[model samples]
Target: MLILGQSPTDAPVGTFGLVNLLAFLCIVPLTVLFAPVGASLAAKLDANRLKKVFAVVLLITGVRMLAQLLL
Candidate 1:
């Protein structure tokens, strides 16, 4: 939607601003380096344990967001 000028907000569509581009460039190297390590770790982990950990993380994040919204 952002690229097609269909976003609800007023930001200009179809253009990458300098700040956005720079932030993406900075993240690219970190992602490239860490993704392979994360993949290897995940591959060695037990699937059921990973699922439980992921569920707990999601639950904690959801509760935090809900608390922030309520407060």
Candidate 2:
């Protein structure tokens, strides 16, 4: 991916860190803007069904984390 005497990683550490920080910074506002919209959509769906699905997913994640910790 190098051209014109430049590879992407040739960028300075500070420059790369700043770019990454800015990218994450942008996600904050986006989450704030979309939170209410996503909440409304989920609310319109069958709440009980969604809750059951979410509970199963959470249980699986918790089990996996515990297994990893025990190992």
Candidate 3:
């Protein structure tokens, strides 16, 4: 919405690209900080239970998308 809403205002191309670049830059430090924490959490979760949790999440998201498209 920011991009589309601002596009009509004559915001410069470089401004849009800079925002994109800054957002992308945020990922590097975040991954460096969270990767070890995520790995430790994953190690504590049982594989089969984790798989079932992911399956349920996917199923719910899929159903929600289908509902949105249909209704």
Candidate 4:
């Protein structure tokens, strides 16, 4: 929604400006190179383990957001 709501001329927030675009461009090649490796590793992981890992990631992300809000 943020992307759709934003106009081209809108001031860039830290994640949505020209600098971020350049950074994304720079990382695209690396992402392309490593994504398949990541996919293979994920594919090898058991479904239950993957779900637990994903849950932990989400839990950590939620805690970080809560910390930021409190701080």
Candidate 5:
């Protein structure tokens, strides 16, 4: 991630960390805003197929979160 003009990994503690944390926090509203776009794409495709794809996506997300916690 870029902050001001510096890379995140090169930034000092609390600087990039807070920025990343806040960015993650914005996912809620961002998802809401993009929901329509996603729905449109899903419609253009097949709704049933998209639902299955999203189910797998959610499953992978859950597994990744679980692996993170376990690790």
Candidate 6:
């Protein structure tokens, strides 16, 4: 986003800062609500199982991003 703002465009440079601030503001409340649930889930899940799940999720997300670009 910062790089895009740096390019020749109509967008104001402060747009990056605005986006970052908005993202932070939006995430803080969600973190507060979900962190406890995540922590509890982590406690229940085996470490190896969590690692595998995280890896698969990341792979799927990467594939989805690539597909988006291709499509």
Each candidate structure's TM-score, on Cα atoms with residue i matched to residue i, is 0.58, 0.43, 0.48, 0.61, 0.50, 0.64
List model 2 lDDT by residue over 1-71, tens digit each. Answer: 12234335766443343254455568889999999987887888798988987899899999999999999
What are the Cα lDDT values of the candidates? Answer: 0.74, 0.73, 0.74, 0.79, 0.76, 0.77
Q: Where does model 3 exceed 4 Å of error?
A: 1-19, 56-71
Ordered from best to worst lDDT, the candidate numbers read 4, 6, 5, 3, 1, 2
Pick the lDDT winner: 4
The candidate, 3 or 4, that scores higher on TM-score is 4
Candidate 5 TM-score versus the reference: 0.50
lDDT of 4 by residue, 43-70 (tens): 9999999889889999999999999999
Task: List per-candidate RMSD values in Å.
Answer: 4.4, 10.0, 6.6, 4.3, 8.3, 4.3
lDDT of 1 by residue, 14-68 (tens): 3353234456678899999999998987898899988987899999999999999
lDDT of 3 by residue, 1-71 (tens): 55444443564444462245466568888999999987887788999988887799899999999999999
Candidate 5 residue spans exceeding 4 A from truth: 1-25
In model 1, where do residues sit more than 4 Å from their true spots? 1-27
Q: Candidate 5's error at 8, in angstroms?
A: 28
Better of 2 and 6 by lDDT: 6
**Candidate 3 TM-score over all chains jointly:** 0.48
* C-alpha root-mean-square deviation, candidate 3: 6.6
Q: Which ten residues in a row have the lowest lDDT in candidate 3?
A: 12-21
Candidate 5, residues 5-70, lDDT tens digits: the string is: 454566544555335545556877999999999879887878788888999999999999999999
Candidate 6, residues 1-71, lDDT tens digits: the string is 55344433554443453255556678899999999998998899999999988899999999999999999
The alpha-carbon lDDT assigned to residue 57 of candidate 2 equals 87
